[model samples]
Target: MQPKDWQKDFPVAEPQPFTQPHELPGPYGPPLIGHLLQISSEQSHLTLERWAERYGSLFQIRLGRSRLVVVSDHKVIQRILEQRPQSFRRNCVIEDRFSEIGINGLFTAEGEDWRRQRRTVVAALSRTRLASFFPRLKATTARLQRRWEGAADGNQLVDVCRDLTRFTVDVTMQLAFGVDPNTLETPGPVIQRHLEKIGPGLQRRFFTLFPYWRLIRLPPDRALDRAVKALDREVEVIIRATREHMAAHPGHGPTNFLEAMLMIAEHEGSNLTSADLLAHTSQLLLAGEDTTAYTMSWIVHYFTRFPEAFARIRREVDDLIAPAAALDKLEQANHLPFLDAFCNEVMRLKPVAPHMALETLEDTEILGCLMPKGTKLFVLLRYAATREEHFAGGDCFDPERWLPQPAGHGNQPHNTQAFVPFGAGPRICPGQHLAMLEIRAVLAMLCRNFDLRPVSHGKEVKEKMAVVMRPDHLHLRLKRRSLASSVPTCAPTAMAASRSGASHDL
Candidate 1:
């Protein structure tokens, strides 16, 4: 009601004179809908961007009686991110809905339950394992490339989003757990359909009329139940298969993520149950597959929007990774400047999802305002990345902003404190290292062998959000790139000065 009133409603350890949490400006929208329709699942980030412009970033909106405070300021985001398991927890409304379906994995678990499971995950997905995992990643991307090559031969349009989805699912399953769920090879991919269902269903969970939709026998509720059942069936089978394989190969040192986790579970005694194993496997599969896929799709989407940028990226891939030297031969290019910058730019512009919802563990102070326990806090990731204050030409596709600055240049580039595509702080994504390699592999292979020709060239493609955000109308054909372009055209500059190339000029 007043600038000072919300602080009294939400007392914290220490509070300063600031606007009441509720008094923070926002388009509250209708009482029931609460901007739900305005920011529909089809383009939530776009709507949020519009609101962020209107409300000046720090604002609040209601979602089914839950007061959601959206933070686009990088410093505020930094504050919330630092308060991981102790002060802020995963959003209960979304996480609880997942738990109800018996999928309470690391993403949902809080307190020590989260910490313990997270340690296991980190250990399983360690960097050493990625060397062994790289072959699988390359194999999966190569397989998808062959399929696209076939499509290019016949003048067929490729569903880049779906293919990337299949590719990531194939890679994620094998690399994470050493199973071949081969959605890429399957004609009518059952698991892929189930995986696709989850994003939309998860969206429904966050923005529906009633928060407790499982209590209601609505269409969305029934479909979500069916989707979970199908997903459970598929994932549990893989868990059983992994268990059997581990048993068969006794005394084997941990090879992939599953084996590493199994070893931990065995040595750690009875703390890790079979159900916990199954739940973690499900979480890994679901989280790993879609997030990587759609982010890559958005990368492709950016390339389509800016052809010259795409040409420069393709040139970088061609010269650097040409003839695609064996994974074992791959070197210190982990810091491949241009490639890294391109991926970074894509994530900044189009993050895996628009926002990550966190719930407060205790009464916490955000931006000097008290937020009582159970407050719904949204890290407006897309907004922060696109804000004029945080970035120069934030809406423009400029990867150079991520490149290292040239020597003797007395200039500060854009602020990147808001760049948390894989998240930050202690609870940052465990699979992030592996995900980067996977992304590099896909980007290199696809760009080297083919030119992405958008089917609807020059038309605006909107984002479809669920658990992951993807292009709603993206279709491209992989027309083979000539060997001439594959050959080094210009001596590549240090990526710092590479901005002299046409990235900004275009």
Candidate 2:
């Protein structure tokens, strides 16, 4: 069904106020465990989506001893999301787990604290600021291209996820702190090694019914502790170095997020502390890496499945940026409408964050069901995105739906609200602008310089849950384009270091 036709069948309904919480529709599960075992699997979002199909838009599902109100309705979810920090906040368990690992910053903060920290973060990643950081980002992309070039030349299989992680780590470290740990070229005891352990550890604890790690230190738990301590030591060194730079220059202004945050904390009458700065810094580092890396990885996965889209992007990139190997200007990244549309489709199909967990701060009535205070709500972001009721052939990977059509064409409108990949409303991911720029730069560069061929079979590729959803065991082979120019041979280490001091001229 087309989007215009599906809306007539499924209209966004107003609250009925007649239904109660216990009266909602759901599946019957085993006595004590409820749906814990099935939902605790790595593909929990898929499980919730399947249940959404069976039980209608809204349903109640119990995981272990706790009952959660699962919602797949986008309109309802939007209404609830807009009331954040006041009417609803992130589930306390999420904050508790993140706080335990020392990463509970802007992502998990609430009320006034969230407001203050968000200002600093928004300033750091703002589009104006991102433009100034483009040279560093471009240099990082050039390094990744070099890595792929070597792989293509040797006919070696490229671990797409691992390489993309390195790309993001290199880009993020420079932006987060004014330092370059170019993991793409140098492979040693860097920040990426420690960051790799943090995501899985957090995910393991999030789904576990009880906090067993606190009582007994398992191998993984001990490793997590060591990773945290090591990461803290690294961050402490960065803080000391930044302070010394500031003291020596005296005339120089804050250059990076860490510097900006440190300056804020040092300001008189500011409420933020050293611990708060550390948490927010770690938050940006982790937040910047996985989402964008997994997104590009999924784009590559789709390119292998749909070669026509790959050709289309390559043609677009070739026309737009032919002489240059990769995008040089920040504005050039914005001009590729087709590449942007293609990314929109990829995100719609495989959102890194498929669901967002929140808790009600006050008793609320949604649709017809009354949710009491402290009730857990699972908003299925990807569920409604794939439903035919909101999109035309929603399950399929089609990019044209996101593009503009002639007026007389069958009116297949795109519902932007239904697809909340980065989430919606005030607390939406602040890094979205940065993520999109990074995606455009890297993918455009890939299409321009190489052809992606899948190394793993379709069935062999799995979606494993970590800090965010990622393509597990995904491998690809890149063949350098014959007609395309050779990849840039600039030394990224020097480029990054020279540009490190040249931050956004805010």
Each candidate structure's TM-score, on Cα atoms with residue i matched to residue i, is: 0.88, 0.90
Residue 95 lDDT in candidate 2: 93
lDDT of 1 by residue, 1-506 (tens): 12223333433432344556787778857876677666676566667667777876567887655678877766666666776888788788777777776677778888888887787678767777666566676677768877888889998988888888888888878877788887877787558787788778777666776755645667877777798889888877877787898899899887666677778888877577777777777888888888888888888888777778777877676566555531223453452567677878888888886777887777766656667777788777777777666677768877877765667542544766667787777778787776777777777777677777788866668777877788877998778867654676666545443232212210
Which regions of candidate 1 are displaced past 4 Å? 1-19, 32-37, 271-273, 324-328, 332-335, 406-413, 457-459, 489-506
Error of 1 at 221 (Å): 3.2
- Residue-pair clashes per prediction, in order, are 1, 0
lDDT of each: 0.72, 0.80
Per-residue CA lDDT of candidate 2, range 1-506, in tens?
11112223335563344466567888887877788787764778888889988987788887777788888888878877888888889988889998997877888899998998888788888888888899999999999999999999999999888889889988888987888878899866677788888888888787777788889989989988988888788777777888898888886677788888778777755776667667777888888898889999998888888898888777777777776888988877766767777888888889999988898887776666677788898899988888887777889888877666557754564567788888878998888888888999999899988887887665587778786889887898888887535333332211111111111111
**What global local distance difference test value does model 1 have?**
0.72
User: Candidate 1, residue 33: CA error in Å?
Assistant: 5.0
Among all windows of 10 consecutive residues in model 2, the one with the lowest summed lDDT is 493-502
